[model samples]
Every structure is written in structure tokens, then in C-alpha cells.
Target: MSNNGDVFVIGGVEHMGHVGMMHGVDPNPHMSLYAAKASGMMGLTAEMLGKMHGITREAQDAFGVRSHRLAHQATVEGNFKDEIIPMQGYDENGFLKMYDFDETIRPETTLESLAALKPAFNPKG
Candidate 1:
């Protein structure tokens, strides 16, 4: 996926942000150039960018929870399990062949727990 044609990046005044190569998947690349005019984010810290765009911390936290849920599902369901290779496990001395899927699933993804959990980002500040 190496291309030397051009590069296009896009961001919004809102919390939403996205970036992609111009020659790759983006059909209308000029829109990214247009968006950069108002974003003023040639390079900016997350907090700084948020402040510049009036992105509230509460709103960011809400979006973080939603992203966590989506990631939890994909990880637990082994959405990309087919990419895993079958490995061998040994008991005592003999070789035991086994296939491992996902080992990160907990049966506890309730909303109550999610609410109780602290913010998972920007912990230093």
C-alpha cells in the first residue's frame, strides 16, 4: 500500500477526526484541504485542539465509552481470528496441538461497570 501520488488529511471542528491517503480510498480529496482551512490543526495537542474547537471533555468521555464498547465486541468476538495461526502446546513431554482464538473476553461488559470505570484517557492531566 505504498503510494507516492499525494496525501490528504481531514479533520473537523467537532471531536470527530479522520485521516487517509489521497490516492488510496479517498475519492474527493479536495474536501480535506478545505477542512484544514478552518481546523487550524497543522499540529496541535489533543487538549489544545479540543479547546480550539470547543470540544467538551464530557462529550469526549461519552464518545470514549462508545468506542470502548465497539472495541470490546470486536476483540471478544475474534473478529479477526482467522488471522491467528494454530500453535502447539505441551503438557508434560509430548506435543499437543491447539488453536487459540481470543483470550481477552470477560462476561462483564455491563453499562453499570462502564459507568463506574474511570476515564481511560488523558490520565496525566
Candidate 2:
């Protein structure tokens, strides 16, 4: 006999809810030090790590473009139809709408557009 089990994992982030504290909180001296030295923001930390790993900006931009392209292609081909369920959500204009597709997928995203954008965490980089 064999033991079997099924596991389902789901994770998401609501950036709007943390807009005010995007840099993170410094609740104590230790946290303050950590935040000051190693930026409490995940994006900033990732930037630092990428720099340390010698990952070039062009590489990151290319990766982002490729990701958007793949997602857009999948959406157009209805590849995610079975996995995605329609949900009630508010639009930017505050109107109630049924979101049946992945809203984050940007079909128009391109390498030039990504390259023109400044780094979100490190503007200098």
C-alpha cells in the first residue's frame, strides 16, 4: 500500500493595501537598523542581490518582456481558461466587473518599453 495526498497552494499580493508602507516598517531599533542597512523593501533587496550576482539591466528587462509576452500569448490562446475562474472585482474607475482573464498580462509589453522605464528600487542602477 502507498500513502497519497494532494496539496493546493495559492499566494497573492495586494500592493494597494501597502502603498503607504512600501518601504516597510521600523517597529524597533533592530528593525530600523535592518531596514536602514538592507532595505526592508523586497524589490530593493532583489536589486541589490542582482547587482551582486552581476545580472545586467538588459538581462532583467529582456526577462520581463519575455514573461509578459508568454503570459499574453497564453491568455490569447485560452491556455489559462480552465485554471482561472471569473471573479467580481472593481475596476480603476470603481465599477464592478467580472475579471475572467489575468489583468496583469500586458500583451503590448516590449523590450524597448521595459528598457525605457527606470528601475523601481534603484534609480541610479
Per-model TM values vs. the true structure: 0.35, 0.70
- What CA root-mean-square deviation does each model show from the true structure? 13.7, 7.7
What Cα-based lDDT does every candidate model obtain?
0.52, 0.76
lDDT of 1 at 32: 59
Candidate 2 regions off by >4 Å?
A: 1-12, 21-39
What TM-score, to 2 decimals, does candidate 1 have?
0.35
The TM-score of candidate 2 is 0.70
Clashing pairs for model 1 are none
* Candidate 2 lDDT score relative to the true structure: 0.76
